[model samples]
Target: MQLSSFKSFPLNTLGRDFAVGDIHGMYSLLEKKLVAVNFNPQKDRLFSVGDLVNRGPESSRVMSFLGQPWFHAIKGNHEDIAIRSATDPDYMDLMLRIGGAWLMDKSPKEQARIRQTFTALPLAMEVQTPAGKIGLVHAECPLDSWDDMIFLLKAGKQDALHLEEKLCWSRRRFKDRDETLIQGLHALVVGHNVVEGMQIMGNTYYIETGAFLLDGEHGMTLLDLVALKPV
Candidate 1:
């Protein structure tokens, strides 16, 4: 089944909403962080900036985590690789080189299940907060305005595919240190490039603190959307 490229969620009035950076298969570490925050999945929601799989020990368990009703996510570059690698032989090498060796161990059935889940994920998501609307993309927003990106993504044409490439893989914003605030969003959250710590540039937030890194300094980052601060 074809999935829409964008999804919008109403304000989570029942409990707090949190946005987490690229998990990269570190489910255990993520669990520890969630415990520290006293996350009650019954009422709370966890939104992932994507890159939910690959690079860590538990990449195989991504489907189980994604199954949780309280967890929401967008498709990241790694997920794109997972989708393509299943059909396009050319992407397999690229996937393995980028720490997706875990996929090789999965049975054909499991791989298909994983691919289907990735294909179902939207490229962009928006969640309403008292502060305003928060936008989430796996990487940088290729366009100047959040609404424009949403419009283009909804179009889902050839140009939208190009923008999707940028959304999942481009790091130009962080590399150039672009501070241009995207219009029509209270804040834009993303993950892909690892930063030394959680950072904010203009209204965009970079929260991926390199959960895949084995170094002691880096761990999973879960940012509270309402407070716009790391938990």
Candidate 2:
């Protein structure tokens, strides 16, 4: 892990509303889907559910797309791992095992740019949607472990690292506990866990439709916030 001494990027609020699920390095598929949906990079905003890298053949390509101005992404576990590796020299080995190898395989200048981009992603985003306040996090909510929901909410966005484990790793079974029920946020959209199709669990939607699916098989779930529909 070659730790870069750059600061992380803050979360940006954009668009009337648009969202996409886990990319997992399937850059070509993502490009086609964006075209199929007639995505307008300027007027329409794009939100990634996370896991923008790893397990796919083109992590470098995936990062390049994410760097575009039209994209707004929260930090997924993969990004978190890369960040840690980037900042901590000791974790370099771990990073390589995950997806660092692919990222480093790029040209020197390309790798440098990717490192800068990764350093700047936000940990989570809270969007005002018709369905109530929809929170876009990587995976689960950190509020699960806290007995006081108000306290966690008050912590604000600065505490991303403290909540990393749950935000970027927890899955459906882990989030469907009594703790989550008591926390009472409107809905949380996340990725990391692959599903057969898009899932609507309570108000939270898991949209990682396994973009890495091979054999000429790949799928993505697009969420239209205004229409309250997933296509």
Candidate 3:
């Protein structure tokens, strides 16, 4: 909602600014990690690459954090589905199949609130941090050119799906990523494509840890934008 992009929103002024990995119902794990980092919510802030719901228990609980001033998230593929399936039965099967089963039990009012929350989420966010200028997207950013990706994003929705949907669902940029780089970008952070851990390719960082798998080794990958390291 902050016009998709922002500049000079430096983290130095805050307690500590962090970009968290895809939180597929890993709220407790995220809390633990934040505690470990000594995150002071009163002064700190968090930016999420969406997918805050689905594929894990307590997706509903995650919604509680959305209202807090310290938290922000972009639209994720799972959220895209949740919004679509809210009114259209066509997406119901796939939505549940991909971790939207929680929606099935929600009251109509609760479901509407969730839909409203997600529908308001931007497809991407760009900010200037102490580390550098960072761009956060649910999936990929045009590794070849940020201009190409921004063009599509600013133009808004499409016929079958919005440009945001394409951006939120893409994984193509990661293939052969060794050869890829976003010229002037300091870091283009993303989730959606789960990895063994946080992997950096050129200036792009892929941090989806698949916390929903409930694997002991997997949890949210919190990027310390202030320190430019994973916390």
Candidate number achieving the greatest lDDT relative to the actual structure = 1
lDDT of 3 by residue, 103-221 (tens): 87989998998898887887777777766778888887643676566655565432233455556887777766654777546788889888888888877788898787754545678
What is residue 114's positional error in candidate 3, in angstroms?
Answer: 0.8
Q: Which pairs clash in the backbone of model 3? A: none
Clashing pairs in 1: none
Model 2 per-residue lDDT tens digits across residues 1-231:
111211122233454566788887878887877777788787666778778888777787787776587777877888877767656876668877766688666686776667667666665666665555566777766564322432443455334545556667766553453234424445667787777777776556677887777413447777775555675
| Candidate 3 colliding pairs, count | 0
Number of the predicted model whose TM-score against the real structure is largest: 1
lDDT of 3 at 54: 88
TM-score, candidate 1, is: 0.94
**TM-score per model over all chains:** 0.94, 0.75, 0.87
| Local distance difference test, candidate 3 | 0.77
In TM-score terms, candidate 2 sits at: 0.75
Ranking by lDDT: 1, 3, 2
lDDT of 2 at 22: 83
What are the runs in model 3 whose C-alpha is more than 4 Å off? 1-11, 151-162, 215-218
What's model 1's overall lDDT? Answer: 0.87
Off by over 4 Å in 2: 1-16, 87-94, 107-113, 144-161, 172-185, 214-218
- Give me the displacement of residue 207 in model 2, in angstroms: 0.7
* Better model by lDDT: candidate 1 vs candidate 3: 1
